[model samples]
Target: MIVSKRIAAVAAAVGLAVTGLAGTAAAAPAASTDLRLIAFNDFHGNLQPPAGSSGRVVLSNGTTVDAGGAAYLATHIAQLRGQVKNSLVLSGGDNIGASPLTSALFHDEPTIDFLNQVGVSASVIGNHELDEGYQELLRMQFGGCHPTDGCQFEKPFRGAKFPFVASNITFDNGLPAALPVTIKFVDNVPVAIIGVTLHDLPSVVTPEAIKGLKFGDEVQALNKTSRLLDLAGIRTQVVLMHQGDSTEGGGPDDCRTLPGPARDIATRASASIDVFLTGHSHQQYNCVVTDPAGNPRPLIQGASFGRLLSVVDLKINKRTGDVDRSATVAHNEVVTRTVTPDPTVQALVDKAVTLSGPIANRQVGTITADLTRTASPAGETPLGDVIADAQLAGTQGNQAVIAMTNPGGIRTDLVYATSPAGEGNGVVTYGEAFAVQPFSNIMQTITLTGAQLKNTLEQQWQASGTKFLQISSSLHYSWSQSATQGNRVSNITVNGTPVDPAGAYRVSVNNFLAAGGDGFAELKNGTNLAGGPVDLDAFTAYLTAHPNLAPPASDRVTVLP
Candidate 1:
């Protein structure tokens, strides 16, 4: 189901490569005029085989196929590089952390080791890399002091294989050196790749994880850095960006239509960038986008967690030393599940699976009913509501009148549990729930006026697809999208009747959204009356206390006319 749109231009006379079909292999010219590049993003540490069905990915042509896994990806990469004299492999960030039990349990050490074996040239540091403390990120990148926590059976942590790239993030005083902005050459091509995580990390991530960091403007940072790289004579450029768009499809191979942050920024960027490898939204796409400069630039992103591989083949003109005007080629290889797991990657995973045998098999807790995360009728989700409720309950305050949770914070979908069961052989395990909410987020309580609360609701539509506020208890309002943006919320109520617009309210939420992250402007404006308690700890406590807790059906928060 992998979709591709090939734009082959020979001196302004353009011919579209046949859609839904692979392009015929171009004959290799002697002393080849073309150089090649391969890129991927948002891997999120899915080292084992994917969750469900396994089958070959079929191209539009009737011929059958096989794809994916680090080894298969390695094989494809090796084959592609063999065809061209110069080649580069790069990532769009989030290559590690917020992953499955196989990788997450060990804090992504195995994932890093695998990347080392794969010869990944460079990578952008995705937001999840900062899911643990920033110091944890340093530990993953460089060596660190350690005492064996329950992981005594496993091998000691080995640090990163390659340096992580982050041009816009800077540490406060007393912090270590920041990651380099650009990588110079792979086979002496002078290729420059700018790495940028989302600018809203402080609000999008658990506050404890990103407390001492600052996320700068991605567009501004890239623009200045691209200028610097251009001035230094680096012609070939790519942005390994973690921001992504949404998509509609049943499985991995479905084509994407709505572009996310990558599209908006790519469309407005300078002419220096030639390609964009994006992630974060877990969508699949292969298409060419034009920057503000009006030049067509190529881009690709696979579905999350090794579900697919986006193989972008670029032919750099030998004479111009840039993207070949005449022979540019691009397509994606969906990593179907059915293929025999690549022996090498499988071997590596098998080794990790053996080492993690005890933890992987242990059970944590169970749900009495389905804990689905799909958006609700009011654009808020019950999963989000449950998460917010846990955060509120975790905070020991008497006057916690309200709460909020970001949709992005809920990382997995939970099915209803038939009964509470024992460890390793029960309904759900500690490993499973931890995988669902892996980030170390802390619950936060902030005070805001009912007026500010109204503004927060209004901001949801200021931009489409923003996470609507999922309330912990009863907070009522109505909106009509047919009307104005922020003015949509009406019939404001807290317990039952109506909430006074000027009255003060104490609200609980994660640290991420409270800091104006993800474009929720009102959250940034709320008064930090007080903040305390780890959100993750609260979530763990809730699960431990209510092993058979059913999702509440009383939908208190709503969007109305």
Candidate 2:
């Protein structure tokens, strides 16, 4: 243990070795320099116990355990905090937006309230933070009534006490919108944490949400921020990054096969960064990657929905103010149900549930079976088909004959069994539908030539190697794994008519797709655009119109050998 503690003296916040002129042995390390960093990410306003698979964690032992809830998280956090005197709790963002019914109903006030109550120092701005747009995000930071919705809570809604930092986001004028670094003192030691979202924010977020804001290069931003912090004499630096990598077929805590933007960033960024707390991929990993200078840096992501918590022990050297990287150790801990739920957090949750219950619990429609998000090899999911159809229906007034949606937009599986929201088996509710398509994206109809539609589909496999789009019943096509990328999509038809290069057709898509979000730049080529209802409204209307919605056969897209 002494040896482990001795290594905490990394280049940042680390005290130099106090050796005599005669080369005396090093003295005992100071206990006051130890700083406990408790971190989590991608919370997404899951104030209640997350439903179904969202609330479960699979341990390295291969056993699945139920986890998460604000109450239990509060208990776990307080207990962990109690064990250490000098500590700072942090998050990697997505703390709000894409939220469940309980928090989203009031515009995620409860999420901010929870964070403030728990003493979260700061968080980076995630893609979801812009879900409602920049002005809305500002409102979240500095409280007021919704421009349209007014205040939903009983009392006036005061905003977050913690600061939001996004090192890479800047105004069109090149001025930073958020502070690049936040400094906190623990035992008179200043620890600087730099925060930034992924570099590819424009690709994943709606164009409307990021209208005039520009996301700067992440590596450049971090390097500049670290240098500034170093100049300011705050060398014990960490990065709260809202981007991550996934290890295929690896356990939650496995890092042996790491490959993703997070790893790539660690490989490119300056070695002065001691650790990275990442999110967005929603995959859990606790691994150390070598930085550009060959120094080891810890990169961790606690899985989404409060299911996991990352606890890190960092010791700084008093005199040098550098991290004892040698003494740093981190691990992802499961927020197991064995821990007692904090009554205070539960009370807050109970009040939120009480206010949100009526609308969330009321049944909207019935389903014959689960409309799972699991896609076939051809990229067709039952839930996706239903969502596509809903968008088509919503845009029919605008002459939309077919619709498509991004697979990543679908958040969860629509189960046939009774849900945690207390609805009956096979019954769907407003809250469930909202949870399925929570981004509040408006449906849009646009005119696209047959060739343009073809280009959009092919573009999916071009830039990023394929993020398949879910198609409406009016559209049908087949692709083969053996064929070349451009030649893969074939037998394309709309309403049983073969696509003609010169023919124009009305296409239905969410505003995100309309703006070429997700790398489908061809979408931006569509002309004669017309706006339609919000996506959730369209989906709820579909459920209301078809009282007994059945899962589409999952046969829309064919995968051939």
Candidate 3:
């Protein structure tokens, strides 16, 4: 009844109803009304418009203007709730974290406030939640770290209003208690939402972050929780899972289709589950999967960064409150920027903007040249070079001798441009730099033999275009792509000519990659490690000390012609 009326409204505004060609007319309402549910996932702190242009979201009647901010999401949630008393709001996971500096700097406090205002009832735990470890998560759920602490700025972080669920994650022997597993009975519907985090949480997050926790099987977790919910007479069951499948769209920022573990688990889920909402991989889709009983269960995920809103309309038998045997409909709606902002939600957005004003407006410095850190022909970029250089510089007199950076660790491209009016100010903001390298990776200095260094270079063969290894001053190596994997590096040098295989060499790298992360096997076996502080700050200090210098473009770590 709501959708039909909505289409009628669209038709009335666009004159589609005048022609009666706006698709099938809504079937007359059955004895029981329809329940509208909304879900979003992987909103990684992109509160701004993901795209440059704004387009009208053609909602029923006179196209209610809407868009992607948490404010707009709140507006949408409010409007939907107005339509159906039984409406539910939920997330697949990764609602924040891995976001722009505006939110990340505050440990994603603004995000929790926005979610609270948007009426999020439940969510799964995403990998990014571990960015600051479980302690920060507690802060997000409760309040800011301290009113006088650096975590607090213009305003204190408003805590989460809803529950965060993660069923399969277990704490360590002496660690603190984790969040609860499931939620039940929203609006007296006897609804049950079971949460499950990704099994590969350790691989994605820093090992130290998950040091005291263990992530268990998603399917098993859901099954156990479902049985518990069923025994409690809760028939309406949904899974809020954080693990995700990939999309055809390349790059971490793009959202495409959904497949992989999320879909597989949904298709094989216990019959008790009516639907599954997924995240983690940042893909988007509305797929209907059949359970073992051949019953169609809906699998859904909204694209990342609040770019889309997934809506599932289900018909429940009034008496049993069970989804009607043949009445489930699913679709994803893009959150276009044209939607009018709901005043209340806009108020929340304004507060966040005001809170972030000082730091958001500050300019840090400028990239003297185009500092890039993506996979390159020389196996490294200016950005990678900058990061490595900073690490070595930070530990100059400390226990560090050489610093190494992982090729994959570099996330964004850095380009410099003059300020408008042709001013010499080509400054980069702390926010901009963070965007270029979002991961809060800690630096480590390891004592490695030259033989081990050669082996580390050889590991690049395991992943093509992974030869990116930036150094502080002088480190040179050449490899032929055609050579045998282990024998690729031919001319290995540090500071000048060939390096002595038996000589000890101090090298720098982030803790993750040094621990054989991303399958870089040689890094794990390296010797004598030191350091646990954020590498970006070190880089900032280096830049502050030398403001006018630019790293020379060298073909040191090169692919032999």
Best by lDDT: 2
Pairwise TM-score winner, candidates 1 and 2: 2
- Model 2: residues >4 Å from true position, as ranges? 1-32, 61-63, 256-258, 462-465
Lowest summed lDDT over 10 consecutive residues: which window, candidate 2?
15-24
Pick the winner on lDDT between candidates 2 and 3.
Answer: 2
lDDT of 3: 0.66
Please list the Cα RMSD from the true structure of every candidate, rounded to 1 decimal place. 8.4, 6.0, 9.8
What's each prediction's TM-score?
Answer: 0.78, 0.91, 0.74
The whole-model C-alpha lDDT of candidate 2 against the native structure comes to 0.82
Give me the runs in candidate 1 sitting further than 4 Å from their true place.
Answer: 1-36, 49-87, 145-156, 170-188, 200-202, 206-216, 247-260, 354-360, 368-370, 396-401, 416-426, 447-449, 502-506, 514-516, 519-533, 544-554
Weakest ten-residue segment in model 1 by summed lDDT: 10-19
- The TM-score of candidate 3 is 0.74
lDDT tens readout by residue for model 3, 1-561:
122343334323322111110112336634554666788888777554432111123232323333466656666667666776557688888877767666666667777777776777777788887777887777777776643355553255557777677877877662224443443333233455677888767766777777778887778867866665555555677778887676554222233443478777887778888888788765656667788789988777776677677778777664465777478777777665556776776675566556765665456565577665544676666667777778888776546666777754554455565422132445665655665566877777788889988888777664222445666656777888687768888788777867899998878788778877756668888777777467767766766676664755656577785
Candidate 2 residues 325-424, lDDT tens each? 8788998888877888988888888989889989988777888988887778788889999999988988889999899998888887777778765678
* Residue 216 lDDT, candidate 2, scale 0-100: 85
Writing each residue's lDDT as its tens digit, candidate 1 over 97-169 gives 7676678767777788777776676788888888777777887777543444534323556677666787678
RMSD of 1: 8.4
